[model samples]
Target: MSIKMMPYLILDGNGAEAVAFYVKALGAEVMALQTFGGMPQSPDQPVPDEAKDRVANAQLSIGGAEFMLSDNYPGMAYQLGDQVSVCIITNSKEDSEALFNALADEGTIHMAFQETFWSPGYGIVTDKFGVNFQISTEA
Candidate 1:
């Protein structure tokens, strides 16, 4: 048996934009993008028109690693700086720094990318969409 974990981000109505930004910043590939309107709905539980275009789910791959994301459920409350953070282990220092800087463009940097005790480079940032990230070079 094998076990794997994939982090799922729930953006506050900005999931699609976040996915697009990640594609450019982290060089991630969009595996799938499904909107709420595309999902099958029951007549008794119709989806609201305002949410029809919101992201229901999206799958993205960065290098060989993958993760999923979606817009927050209709009335669910979401707060930034939560306990979860997506960590990326890069192949080289340049890759790690580049990704860290890209994510810091309009985001808050909790830690700047630099030589760390455990790795050649490491940093943490919370992207514009409020998703936290930890970028590091392989140890």
Candidate 2:
């Protein structure tokens, strides 16, 4: 199974600005972008007008490496040093599980391995070295 690792950055609310900056500063290409307002929502979960412009997800490729960015949901607090995570994408479920378990040892499990809308198995963990990781099988 092929595995790819990429850095994911959480921008408090400046994802659009960040994407624009990266495009000019690093010659990055914006691969995809989705806004919070673009997603389907129930009536009870209406999106606020202010958040309509917030980026729900954005992908950029810089120097042949891909990175993801997203604006934090409204009311979500973000701080420096905690805004970055390594995203591990694997093609095999077994590989994803193995990696998740190995990293969970002596580490904190921020999210347990489980099926998610985006992947067959996904989870988050902070390794022994304090590096945050998001492990998942390819969607």
Candidate 3:
């Protein structure tokens, strides 16, 4: 048996916004979204209206890649860190163009997603939520 390692992000109650941003930026598909706010609760502990829509988990896909997100845990700080990032290697020039544009719309492009001397196509951007990403396509 083999196990695949997918990057997981723990947002500070910003999973939904991050997911929406990724959908636009990476053309990522929402594979699944589990929210504590949307689940049935016990009569003793009813789901709070404020938290009902808060995401418990979300799975997003870009091409064959996937990542997970969550907003259920509280008291967690999401300040920028250099611990993790998703490096996306695009499948085609079109994919690279569209995703790079979308990600750059409201985020910082660390290194412009353009042709590099070493690679055919490449770019780097930090999404709106401060998640760093690397995008590239073959020549």
Candidate 4:
């Protein structure tokens, strides 16, 4: 299956800052950014004040390579050195599902394979070795 992989950084309420820093340090260019407050609101899970100003997602490019990052959800625990995850973009829903299920085997499934606004298939999993992965199918 055709696929693309990119690094996803989870910062501790400093994703915007990190994005700016990386832009200058790595000569990256901002591609897109979405803040928590900009996301569609849900009555069941409202966005917290502390997270409203934080980044929900940010995409960048450095030397033609895609880079992405986001802030930890409000009230979520933050641990140093565990901020990075691998994001895999597959060409088909089947490829996304297969990879996610394979990684979730003997591991943890953070989010079961499901459809999302951005893709037909998406999920999050942390493998047995504790390596987190974000799987998504191209739109």
Candidate 5:
């Protein structure tokens, strides 16, 4: 089987909320969303009610690429230094604007999506998860 590197973003503890944000901003289609508290495989694991809905794993598709997101596992200490970000590329003007507007809500919009010499409908933002995203539709 061929292996692929899917972008996995780790959020502090707001993964579910972050996923919702992405849905609006990127117009992403959610393929799967699971939480540690809801996983049958790990039923015995202790989970607080608050973390039950936190994203254990979420699969989303944008710009024809598969992307993944999750929250830090409880009790697993992490510091989350800035290292990488997943970029999304759109194919149409409508798709670009739809995604840009969606993502801009509840998050910081670094740049607004618009047509430019570099590309048509391109913008940048860092979702509430602190994961940077670049949205663009090719010229």
Candidate 6:
């Protein structure tokens, strides 16, 4: 199995606008876009009204380089300039889990590794060094 990584851009509720900007300026091709409202709803933690219009995730490509971004989840702190992260694409679910666990040691697990609508296993973590990573398993 092969692995790859890309840069991830985090936006403070301006993901849609940024996506438009990038498409216009960088000529990026949007691979997919999922808004918070587009996510499957749950009775326990329904999507907040404010988040419905915000971007949950968006994937794009500029030539061969793939990158992604999303609006900060509702009610979460959004610091200025904390906009970049890394996304690791792995072919195996086991590899994704191992990487998530390793990065989560002495670090923050923003989202637990689990199956999502987009991938078999996906998660987010901020390493001890404050570097955030989003691990995704290709379908």
Runs of candidate 2 exceeding 4 Å displacement: 40-51
Off by over 4 Å in 1: 83-139
Clash pairs for candidate 4: none
Write the candidate numbers in order of decreasing TM-score.
4, 6, 2, 1, 5, 3
lDDT of 5 by residue, 23-132 (tens): 99989999999887776544475677777777876889998988887887666655767424565666677877777678777888867877755477778677776767
Candidate 3 Cα errors over 4 Å, as ranges: 43-45, 75-139
lDDT of 4 by residue, 1-139 (tens): 9999999999999899999899889999999999999998989989989989999889999989998999999787788988999999999999899999999999998889999877899999999999999999999
Error of 4 at 45 (Å): 1.5
C-alpha local distance difference test of each model: 0.81, 0.90, 0.72, 0.93, 0.73, 0.93
Lowest lDDT sum, 10 consecutive residues, model 6, at 73-82
lDDT of 1 by residue, 1-139 (tens): 1223467677888888999899999999999998988887869979998889899768899999898788866876577746356877777888888888999999999788988655798897989988888787867
* Residue range 3-116, candidate 6, lDDT tens digits: 999999989899999999999999999999999999999999999899999999899999988999999997898897679999998999999999999999999998999998
Please identify which of the two predictions, 4 or 5, would achieve the higher TM-score against the true structure. 4
To one decimal, what is the Cα RMSD in angstroms of model 1 from the true structure?
Answer: 13.2
Score candidate 3 by lDDT. Answer: 0.72
For 91-110, candidate 3 gives per-residue lDDT tens digits of 57677767777988889887
- 23: Cα error in model 4, Å: 1.4
Q: Tell me the TM-score of model 5.
A: 0.53
RMSD of 4: 1.2
**Tens-digit lDDT track for model 2 on 66-139?**
99988988876677888999999999888999999999999999889998766899998999999989898987
